[model samples]
Structure formats: structure tokens, C-alpha cells
Target: MNIVYWALVFFGTFFFMEFMAWFTHKYIMHGFLWHLHRDHHNKDHDSWFERNDAFFIFYAIVSIVCFYLWSYEDVWFCLPIGLGILAYGIAYFVVHDIFIHQRFKMFRNANNWYARGIRRAHKIHHKHLGKEDGENFGMLIVPFKYFQK
Candidate 1:
């Protein structure tokens, strides 16, 4: 029963991260913290990294704290939650940074419906360099309109 419970908790956190990513992208990245995220859209930096990378560091710290709690403080559920958040972070890195932004060399040829849709939606979002005009913030749950050929 513990396995099942932990499994459910793990997947629940994984799925919930989509909503969290969207909300954070819409509000925080586009809000007062836009200075941190602005370089991501504006691409003004000479280096490959942007100030926006701090958000990933923030979430990584949170996941690390969850892992610490699960390991040391007897908070068993935190293990699955931490793993789930790590999974989502990896997915976001793969999809958003690697695939769409082509930060790395892999996944460039992923032309499937889902991959294409995600790329399309991200393109639309990046079309607006400014904070206010972007759309399609979520990486996994892109709008259906992007699915069309």
C-alpha cells in the first residue's frame, strides 16, 4: 500500500507541475520578476545562459529540500514529490530548452504531432519578446490549434 500511495503522490506532483509551470510563466516570469525572465525572450545575452535560469535553480533547491526531508526528517511522501518535480524539471529542460530553443544538439528532428505542437506553441509564445503579449506558456498542455498541420 505504501508503494501505491507513493506512486500516486509521485505522479500527482508530476502532473501538477504543468499547471505550476503555466501559472508561474504567466504571472511571475511576466510580472515583477520579468527582469529575471526578460533575457530569455529577448535573447540579449552573449552567453548561453539567461537570468531566467535562476527559476530552475529555485525549483531544484525546493526539490532538494524535499529530498532532504524524505531522507532525514521521516517525511516519506516528500521522496516521491521530489522525484516528480525532478522529472518535470528534466522534461522542461528537454522540451523547452533543448528541443524548442535548441540549446543542445539532440531532439532536433522530433517531428511527431505532440512534439510539433509543443514547438509550435512555444514559437508562438516566443514570438512576443515582451512580457505582455506571449501565449502558450505550458510545455506539455499546448492548445489544440497547434496540433493542426
Candidate 2:
């Protein structure tokens, strides 16, 4: 039962992060914190890193704190929670940064319907250079219209 509970917690947190990502991207990132996120929509610098990367650092710290609580405070559920957040962060990095933006120079040849759809949705999102009029904010679960041929 403990294993099942932990698994549920892990998977639940994993899925929830998608909503969190969408919310943060739409509200926080595109909202008052547009200064931190503007570089992502419109690249004006030559550096490899953007100010938008600060968002990842914030989530990473949260995951680290969860792991610390699980280890030291004996909060067993924090282990799964931390793992879930970390997993989502990794998926976001791979799908958004590496695959979509080609930041790592890999995953370039993956040209399937899903891949194309993801890129198309993201392209639409990036079409808006400013903080307004943006669409397709979520990373994993894009809209079905983007999946059309």
C-alpha cells in the first residue's frame, strides 16, 4: 500500500506540473514577470542562456527542498513529490529546450506527427514576440488543432 501511495503521489505530481507549467507560463511568465520571460519569446542577445532559465532554478530548488524534507524530516511523500517535479523539469528541458529550440544540437531528426505537432504548436506560440496574444502555452498536452495534417 505504501508503494502504491507513493506511486500515486509521484504520478499525480508529475501530471499536476503540466498545469502548473501552463499557469506559470500564462500568468506569471507572461504577466508581471515578462522581463524575465521576454528573452524567451524574442531573442535579442547572443548568449546561450536566457533570463527565462531562472524559472527552472526556482522549481529545482523546490524539488531539492522536497527531497531534503523527505530525508531529514521523515516526510516520505516528499520523495515522490520531489521525483515527480524533477521528472517534469527534465521532460520540459528535453522537449522544450533541446527538441523544440534545438539548444543542445540533438533530437533533430525526430520528424513524426507528434513531433511536428509539438513544433507547430510551439511555433505558433513563438509567433507572438511580445507578451500578448500568445497561444499554445502548455508543453506536453498541446491542442488537437495543432495535430492536424
Which candidate leads in TM-score?
A: 2
| Residue range 22-137, candidate 1, lDDT tens digits | 98999899998999999998878699888999999989998999999999999999999999999999999998889888899998888898988888788888889898978845
Q: Put down candidate 2 lDDT per residue, 1-149, tens digits, no spaces.
A: 99999999999999999999999999999999999999999888999999999999999999999999999999999999999999999999999999999999999999899999999999989999998899845799888888866
Measured with C-alpha atoms, the lDDT of residue 39 in candidate 1 is: 95
Lowest summed lDDT window (length 10), candidate 2:
135-144
| TM-score between model 1 and native | 0.96
- Per lDDT, the best of the predicted structures is 2
| Candidate 2 local lDDT, residue 20 | 96
